[model samples]
Target: MKFIAHINIMPKTELLDPQGKVVVKNLPNLGIQGVSDVRIGKHVTIALEAPSEQEAHDKVELACSKLLANVIMESYDFVIEAQ
Candidate 1:
């Protein structure tokens, strides 16, 4: 079976997002208002082969924990679908 995973990685809420802050600061300069804050994150998509949905889920989780996301600073979530 083939699976496609859509993953989102974001900085932990307790940490400051410098990129998001910069964007928020500049938004007002562009005449944009009413937005109090912003947070930047990463979206990743991967396609892989697995025998079962459970296997695909485990594989994606291992990938996220080992390489894709920084466990200390970033948190990640993923959804896997048949492809």
Candidate 2:
């Protein structure tokens, strides 16, 4: 089976996101107000060969834990879909 994995990696809420903060601050200047506490994150797409949805999920989780995200400061989520 083929699976498409969509992953999102973000810094923990307890940590400061300088880039997100900058964007949030700039939004008001651009006439976009009432938005606060914005946090930036990364998105990754991966195609994988697996026998089942569970297998694909496991593979993606392992990849995120080992390489895609910094477990100490960041967290990740993924959705697996048939492709």
Candidate 3:
């Protein structure tokens, strides 16, 4: 089976996000307001072949843990879909 994995990795809440803060502060000037608590993150798209949805999810999780995210300061989430 083929799967598409969408992964997002972000800094932990306790950590400061300078880029996100800057964007949030400037959004009102750009006529985009009322958007509070914006945090920046990384998105990754993965295409892979797996035996099952669970296998695909496990592969993505392993990838995130090994290379995609910094487990100490960042967290990751992913969605797996048939492709």
Candidate 4:
């Protein structure tokens, strides 16, 4: 079986996102208002072979923990689907 994973990596809430903050600070100049506490994140897609959805999930989690996301300051989530 093959699975496709959609992953999102984001800075932890307790951590400050400098890029997001920069965007928020410049929003007013673009006439955008009322949007606050913006946080920026990343999306990743991967396709791989697996025997089961649970197994695929576990693999993706390992990738996230070991390489994709920074466990100290970032968190991640993923969705696995058949392809």
**For model 2, what is the error of residue 30's alpha carbon versus the real structure, in angstroms, after optimal superposition?**
0.9
lDDT of 4 at 18: 96
What does candidate 2's lDDT look like per residue over 23-81, in tens digits?
99899888998997899999999999998999899999999999999989999998998
Worst ten-residue run, lDDT, model 2?
A: 28-37
Off by over 4 Å in 1: none
Which regions of candidate 4 are displaced past 4 Å? none
Per-candidate local distance difference test: 0.96, 0.94, 0.94, 0.95
The TM-score measured for candidate 4 stands at 0.94
Superposed on all Cα atoms, the candidates' RMSDs to the truth, in angstroms, are 0.8, 0.8, 1.2, 0.8
Candidate with more favorable, higher TM-score: 2 or 4: 2
Error of 3 at 70 (Å): 0.5
Write the residue-wise lDDT of candidate 4 on 46-74 in tens digits. 99999899999999999999999998999
Prediction 4 global C-alpha lDDT: 0.95
lDDT tens per residue, model 1, 31-71: 99988889999999999999999999999999999999998
State in Å the error of residue 4, model 3: 0.5
* Model 3 residue 13 distance off true place after TM-score fit, in angstroms: 0.8
TM-score per model over all chains = 0.95, 0.95, 0.89, 0.94
